[model samples]
Target chain A: MRAFVLFMCLSVGCLAQRPQPCASPPLLTGSLSVSTQSEKLMAYANYYYDALRRRIRLTEFGSYNNKTFHLDVLLLYREGVMYKMNYKNQTCCKKPLSADFHPLEIPWNASLLGQVVIGSSSGPGQGVLVNTWEGELQMKEGPAKYMSTVTEFGCIPVSTLFHTIRSGWMVTSFFNNVIGLVDPQQLIPPHFCQGAQLEERLDEDPVTFFSLF
Target chain B: MRAFVLFMCLSVGCLAQRPQPCASPPLLTGSLSVSTQSEKLMAYANYYYDALRRRIRLTEFGSYNNKTFHLDVLLLYREGVMYKMNYKNQTCCKKPLSADFHPLEIPWNASLLGQVVIGSSSGPGQGVLVNTWEGELQMKEGPAKYMSTVTEFGCIPVSTLFHTIRSGWMVTSFFNNVIGLVDPQQLIPPHFCQGAQLEERLDEDPVTFFSLF
Candidate 1:
């Protein structure tokens, strides 16, 4: 009886110690196509990254119930600020830096979950979904306790274009076309609004994680 | 300039007021096939619901990194307890009741995001993924916010099967067959182990939400 008991202990112990299968982080840069999908709506976005400069540009287009929504932001780490520019409306809004918004930080070291490559059969290529990267990116700063898949490329290659599922938001992002290098000149806007269209804004209300649908 | 400011306010307000598209709670009873996917693993589980009797049975099979995992649980709200019976290992375990463990208490009223029905080409039927009600269901209990969609069947049928993208865990559940009614006898195990195989245990550590991956 004692020997049988010992065998049971070892069996359970072995099962618990089994190793998980995941690849180390791959080289990732950026992309132009990313989208978010929920039960009712699908929104598409674009991203540009200057890895050496640690800069990011994001533009999101959400059309639901016949109304159009847009968020265009440029994050310049060197300047320590984030700018929300709407090209269509010809307005540029600037917000100061705070703990809540760090657009340049990528959660790559978080445990890897898996890899997914999606393609369209008829189209010549594909586009991954890019996250707008709004709200408290600080939630990612906690210890990495869970395992999830990361893409090799896109706005944040190692990060999902969408937010985490834990936030009561299950938004996901995907992109397809792979552009090799972004020209430095491409990062510059043709013009920054100089007149009254440039609005200086303070920290707007921080979006509660749940408020992001 | 004042006219332009008023127009801007109206534009933003109009965009914000656009109504979300969602149906009311769906009348969903049970499903046969549901699967969960993460970066490293994919787990499939089935559920049997006796809605009238308020009983549920879940059987899950997972194959990860060449290892297989199985969980069989019987939840009888009437008895005010839940049972985990492992037929393969010939062991049965039980856990105490808490507001956190009620799998049948659908968070229908919590919030509604959207609804999805997935089916394969070969199978004509469809199923909604019912979470076995494991892990910290506490994650589902919180103030509801966000506007997505809801199904017509579930408590919030217009809502999502399970929260799609939060908790550092993106658990997607899919069922192919819609089982109308569960016969009561199906809920009973053929036999309970008479003596030694039944191990009396306390609340084993509740699985972290990410561990479900």
Candidate 2:
């Protein structure tokens, strides 16, 4: 009986060490704020993600390279295409999106940074329980390190920090996330994107490239 | 008939020029991200607002003055007290709060910049409509200019930009706002704040001061 009790204690200890992986809701919408360490660039956007449909959309308004721009970016993973629409010039650039659809989830090989409560957890429905995970993404150029914090329940992304040699450090925070899409048509290309010019050049900036995921 | 039509057109134009003021929901919760133009300081926090009760709470995690800190701040306007709790040291500071309870609303004297849509607005339920308003706050030290963006439907705060001579510029963005309190007890002071030391010194930083609003 004592040996059996010891074995149960050991089982519980092992379970506590390994946290379960979490995946975000298939169809979600949220607001994203991105800022780089240099502070030269800042972006605010509302994003729509449909993992099942392999589509993502971002309506971004921010300053880049000292110039303010309003851009609408749509990534169609199934079609292997991306449309970047510039509101000021009424122009759209269509480019090949070679990145595969990467679902918002903690990777199996990620290192768990433990769990914490955002607010007071003494009472019911008090605090937000979140898990932090860190991992490295192997890109064609180099490996980028990332740390992501997500809600423990829905796996809704809260914030992500990505560091690359080229980009230094960039943080993307997601907030006001809703579990479902408000309009499916938002995932479709905008009216002005009909005659988008095809561009073969790929964006080398890690901040812009990593955003595809 | 021509005179009547002309009068009606002038009245319509006057009404269009005067945009209506908007107030946020009395009780709401959301996440706030703050950053300065200098790139030295950045903060992330979850805020709980009880406007009707004149109470606000913030659980913040960020780096300040090159030091990482986790702070929980609770403001009780009715009691005219503010408590700042440091999670790392388990210390709480209680101070006299002199600021009046200011409801989150567009000021009557604010200039209406314009209305804009965040996403694609060609179809129903495809975009978020928001209004921007700019105004100045009269403070004891000096006047600080501020611009706020809020949703037109529910007056939910989206982002606010405040500029002062001392703080230069700071932007606070709100997201994932949901109406109603998940836990009313969150507004109450935590148990650790029972014997908080009274702090008489007022913070002079405009970024910290304006956050009271």
lDDT of each: 0.40, 0.75
Error of 2 at B51 (Å): 14
Model 2, B125-154: lDDT tens digits are 323456789989886779989988777667
lDDT of model 2 at residue A143? 96
Runs with alpha carbons beyond 4 Å of true place in candidate 2: A1-19, A37-39, A85-93, A109-127, A134-145, A163-169, A188-199, A202-213, B1-213
lDDT of 2 by residue, A56-164 (tens): 8888889888899777888898998888877677777888887778888788888997665443233233234567799898966799898887776667777788877
**Residue A77 error for model 1, in Å?**
2.2
Count the clashes in each prediction. 39, 1
Candidate 1: C-alpha lDDT: 0.40
Model 1 alpha-carbon miss at residue B166, Å: 20
lDDT of 1 by residue, A103-145 (tens): 3333444433323221111111111111222233334434212
